[model samples]
Target: MDGLPMGRRAFSSTSPSFRATARVGVAATGVALALLLVVAASGCEPVPDGTPYDLVLAEGQVMDPESGLDAVRWVGIRDGRIATISQIPLAGADTLDAAGLVVGPGYIDLHAHGQDEENHRLFALNGVTTALEMEVGTAEVDEWYREREGQARLNHGVSVGHLGVRIAFYDDPSDFLPSGPGGYAVATDEELDTIRSHVRRGLEEGALGVGMGIQYTPGATRWEVLEVFREAATHQAPVFAHVRGFGVEEPGGSVEAFLEVMGAAALTGAPLHIAHLNSMSLEETPRTLQMFEEALERGLDISAEAYPYSAGLTSIQSALLDRYETAPDTALERLQWAATGEWLDRESFNRYREEGGAVVLHLNTPEMEALAIEHPFTAIASDGRIRDGVGHPRTAGTYARVLGHYVRERGKLSLMDALRKMALIPAERLQEWSPDFRDRGRVREGAWADLAVFDPETVEDRATYAEPALPAVGFHHVLVNGIPVVRDGGVVEGVAPGTGIRAGSWSPGS
Candidate 1:
């Protein structure tokens, strides 16, 4: 409490001196009455005694990128919102001494694929408060929200996915994404109408937006994709897309895919988001980002995001992998089996393709990943999914990796810039569709008290591709709606304070 500004102290009614003064005033009412009348005329109100908050994070380096605030301060929380931020010490029922820690808004992962309890626990340990499946979203928004109502560890939501709709219509027995006939076959006119109806219904039922994985559904015609964009435009919702192709190999390259989505945004006037631009564009990332900048300057609402790792993950049965079958030996060398840590040759690639599983493609280089991360317009997202405790390291490590490697160690990005990408940018992207997002992703008074406190020098991601389920290291405290789900570097047992996030309506509980 040293070097802290003093707040107005409340008079102690129980003190012996105060009692003596009261007795004297009662004995000399004439003089005391005049003094009391003068005091009342001054219009000063008495301060009430006791702690003012339920929780206080004291003396932390509070950083809020949205407000451009970065300094040591005290944060007071009461009834699930930030009540005050002060230069003085605050009294509370509980005080966490965070003298050397960085207090910032909790990270929001917009393209998270893992929306279950196990992954939520890991995400909390890494300081993420909201995780949404906006790339390959749910088929039934109602059922998805219902299932995770009181069971989630962090805020969760989904968009209505074109791939999920395709699977549902074709009756494909795929869990994570569509494959086989649903992924490869073009829809008939009746089926297309049914898809449109489902998309519209999902919007009505409170989906965040429309999700389309054009690369996964290669058979979806340009006209069909545009119709989906138009449906989203009708509701004024954004479209999150994994565009049609990958790499810089002309004709049907990543540039063409970027143009296709940008054109849809221009034609339909719907906001568009490109998923994993680094992995999609590869060596052409610089040129691709230039195109995005140009489109943005032209008044088109287009944005892009990327993960920190050099590799990307997907099902072995996906169309992108099928295209790689005819690719060169170098392409096969880039394929890393998820179950085992071995890089694939042509023989191993064929074997895994037949067996059907997830694979990590080492398609992007470190330089390319850095380029995407350093871009001012690009946001950060973990296109991560976890199943049976075996998945990509991005599931547990994306945000921490950005903080640790990009900001702390390499100095490629400043701390404020990294935080903006992880938290503020993602929240801003979704706030138009969901008003609940307006209160998140900031460490300011009156904002929702979802925050992360960590040691700037020590934060690091411990998860690796070989052992992908390990939680991160330096998140000391994480709060959701002013409730601690993580404290002292571990998850607090029996505390599930997270609520479901929905569009066009506030969630029922914090």
Candidate 2:
């Protein structure tokens, strides 16, 4: 052990199992030893696999979510953190031949809804290692978080919904019915204070941020909202807003509602984020972006997120023409375009309609949909949901669809840009949670080795609204904390290697 590396080094006697796992090439052991020794002498930190290497993804189109690089490179992983990502022969481990694949920091989704295990499984198959669940409507959020732990394969995070907070902790229980009559009883300041207190407690307990379905609670006066957001802003948290109305339903469409969120930010001096812009921004994506750009220039902390699909999801109850305006079926049909009728499987819709929700689709313009994805400031989120025993297509198709349609076929965005939106932007937004997650949205020497490997040229999204359960094509390997979740297109099921991400900002009025 004299003059050895600070970390244990393989000397052919490290343990039969460890040796077997390394699978180091016989002839190059000397070269690997040399590189390991040099790195050790320079005080470089050790890799995950203490015995040297377990996996090395070699010579592939490496895409670092933060660096935004797509090139032929070798990424060596020991325990978990990528030890070396070099163009040279970064040795060790059983080689994962990614010669023609697109390698990326595992896709990160900042906005998503409830799609059950079936869809969660599909998400991993498609290479999304992390998903942030920002919907707060299901008031049973605390319990929801409890149930998902050690249960779902993908990494998950949650947000406290403003509307949910009001309904759950402050509202008179009986009044929590469907949106109707263009009005619902608004929460009084006394009631709002109680709800805000509940929200603050949830956020302090690691909830990501505030989620407001402003679309449902239009009666929530701006004053009450500013009170809530100002609280979030004190913690530098971003507020995710579900605008006052779906595009077609609103008098001025998506822009007016988005403008409302921005206006709130301006008034409250709080950061704001528009959720699922693809579904809501319709003919407004371009113009909305122009407004966003102005906000950015003015140094307003504002942004928007969207999924890759053109059709959006929601309850059939949301169709403005069907519920609010009573427009022609054709107009409602246009809005229905984006909603995934697949989940509404005639049976569930019938049940939900008979019992409560009337979930349906809202069709989106292909052009505007494309524009939303290509926008640099817009982060790519699945806005995915769990449904039935499976999940919505966004659970599985989002990242792959972006690669297939946006990067490969449509040429709407470069591979690098897409990866950044998937990982970096979401990661940046996640910083409000904790310092650990702050600078963690990248692929670097000391960063997490959570990785996704696919072939850009061959990567294709197989999940669709009609067939939302299809597994995506082209991910050959996926690693979470350096543990293999998916290896060669198959789930290594029984390993609970992922850790729950925790939120840290909590100083009351900070």
* TM-scores, each model vs. reference: 0.89, 0.81
**How much does candidate 2 score in TM-score?**
0.81
lDDT of 1 at 494: 84
Span of ten consecutive residues with least summed lDDT in model 2? 1-10
The residue ranges of model 1 lying beyond 4 angstroms of the native Cα positions read 1-51, 505-510
**Who wins the lDDT comparison?**
1
Q: After superposition, how far is residue 355 of candidate 2 from its true place, in Å?
A: 4.2
Off by over 4 Å in 2: 1-50, 90-95, 137-144, 170-183, 248-252, 318-325, 335-358, 389-391, 506-510
Candidate 1: lDDT of 152? Answer: 80
Maximum-TM-score candidate = 1
lDDT of 2 by residue, 276-386 (tens): 887777777777778878999999988788887767655444323234243443444333222334333334443454444324355677788888888888999887765
**Which pairs clash (backbone N, Cα, C closer than 3 Å) in model 1?**
none
TM-score, model 1 to reference: 0.89
| Model 1, C-alpha of 86: deviation from truth (Å) | 1.2
